[model samples]
Target chain A: MKQPHIQLKLFAALTPLSPENSDRVPIEPGISIKELLDHLDIPIVKAHLIFINGVKRSLETRLNGGERVGIFPPVAGG
Target chain B: MKNTLSHRLNTLALKASLTDGTPCRTISAAEVIHLADDTGITGRMVEIAALREQILPDRYLRNMKTLSEADQIRLLESAVCIVGLGGLGGLVTETLARMGIGRFYLVDGDMFEAHNLNRQLLSSIDRIGMPKVEAAVMRVKTINPGLEVNATGAFLTSENADTLVGSCNIVVDCLDNIQSRFILEAAAKRAGIPMVSAAVAGISGHVTTIFPEDKGLENIYGPEDQLNMAKGAETRLGCLAPGVNLVASLECMEVVNLLLNPQKALRNRLLVIDLEDHTFETLQLA
Candidate 1:
């Protein structure tokens, strides 16, 4: 049996956290938002907002494959 | 009273040789000043001048389609305080001035560095060392001389925020740091004024309207200690012009909506936009 993967879309300050500056990345399904952030080298502390399938979610929420995840950094710039 | 105001306006219009119901044209600032001095009533002069000169004198003529003349007048009489004259603040002030806001109190303690020219609307090479608030005041004066702008070249803090934001009807948060933003939010809350906050970095931005009773910046950034340990997006990814402009525009719209149609404002909702992928989503805040 093979594990499923979910797609991630990193936005704003979170883009730099991704390797190669790719806008989209694949991650293992069932991984919590916190775990996915860790895998992508994005400090969970740096992310201020997270959305899954266009809905706001907590870091502890688990991701299912085929769902789109968006991560945003706190854009404090004027 | 309406008839008297209209009669005074008509007399002024006749004196200026401005025909009624014509295309918008400019009225010399000198003429308006003289009328203000003669009548001893500046408001009536402004009203008459705005109507006779059409769009040019009114400056907000286009706003008539969306806002009633009374609403437009309300805008002209409203006072808004902009905290931070960097990227977002510069654009917000520019748009608000053009919209005929009556008064402004601009707060910023920083001087324009070479790097600021990349996004700050009031920043130019010649103004590299000028105070941001000074530059903003100069720009506002150029945009709408009728507007009264007070430039405070001091950083907003817990001590001074109350004095700076207390008198204004609305507060715009264009700050670049969480600490300053929190300070501003607290002051705004204490003053019982609504705050329109916008922030951007890279190709994404976020906007929200927070009323006095709302949790505001706290809901988005969490507690101060947690935010203090985290770096802002600008520090990590830098900022771009498009992101700054888009967010500022939205923030300005929110301010206008808050003034003219409070029921339709973004209030309690966080609008997040990712220009990179063209994704815009509004999340309901608790």
Candidate 2:
């Protein structure tokens, strides 16, 4: 079977992790949010908020194919 | 007794009329102070000032259309604590003061630096050495003299957070560090006050409202230990003025909505904005 794919969105400082600061990327399926972060080389400590299909999820949460994922860095500045 | 209040209001109203005679009648800040001093009842003076446009010049004259007279009175009676006086806190305090919020507790331990001129509304080259809280106080006085402000030039710790925010109806999280934000959230929770929090980095930022019953900042930033281990984007990407102002404006709007119409305030969700692509997303918190 062909590998399933998911859409990923990186925000703010996390964009630099990707080429040309592309906001979206396609990822393989059956990956936990933590694994995806690692695959993208985004440190787990740098990923402050993670959401799948508009619902916040923990790092251990598994993502199915075709789901939309959004990741934000901790932006604590006043 | 009602007649006495009306009579005093009318007297002050007459004293406040603009001499320019362009028909945009407005009172000077000096007149309001004089009236409040003479009446020995600042609350009554504030009420009269809010009611009569000519008595205490308000930029929010149109806001009264959406906010009923009673709501305006409520704003005049409300007090909010701003825990920082940097980019976000400076703008938030200015907006609230213009919206006629009656009292403010401005807290910050930092002083204005030359670099702060990039985004801090209250910071300037002339005031580089001045304490941020003092600058905020001066700015609020210039914006609306009727506002009662308590400026604290000390950093907020667990020990002093409660005392600084205990009397406020709401707390705005403007601190730049996760540890300090946790301190503020705990303090607000202990005081049973709702907190409107926001943060900015690059061209993006996020805002959320946390009531006492909610999970609070911990849900977004994770456990205290985890937060201590992590780094904030501001430390890496730095901050942009437009992003800070945008997020702070949204935070102020949430605060006003919370105070006047709690049902409409942003709660239980985080609203994130990316000016780079102009995409705004509201994500539900687990």
Please provide, for model 2 over B59-156, each residue's C-alpha lDDT reduced to its tens digit, 9 standing for 90 to 100.
44456457655677778788999999999999999999888898899999999998889999999889999999999999988877767898899999
Screening candidate 1 with a backbone cut-off below 3 angstroms (N, C-alpha, C), the clashing residue pairs are none
Model 2 chain B lDDT-worst window of ten: B16-25
Residue B110 CA error for candidate 2 (Å)?
1.0
lDDT comparing candidate 1 with the true structure = 0.78
Residue B128 accuracy (lDDT) in model 1: 89
For each candidate, what's the DockQ? 0.62, 0.71
lDDT tens digits, residues B1-286, model 1?
Answer: 6455445454444222224443444444555555566666553337544654342343444554566556776787788999999989999999998877778999999999999888889999999899999989999878755567888999998889999998899999998887888889889998999999988877688999999999888778887766664347777667888989999999999989999899888887889988887978887766
lDDT of 2: 0.81
Provide the TM-score of the second chain in candidate 1.
0.87
TM-score of 1: 0.85
**Candidate 2: where are CA atoms >4 Å away?**
A1-4, A19-27, B1-3, B11-31, B48-59
- Ignoring the other chain, what TM-score does chain B have in each prediction? 0.87, 0.89
Query: Of the candidates shown, which would achieve the greatest TM-score relative to the real structure?
Result: 2
Worst lDDT run of 10 residues, candidate 1 chain B, spans B14-23
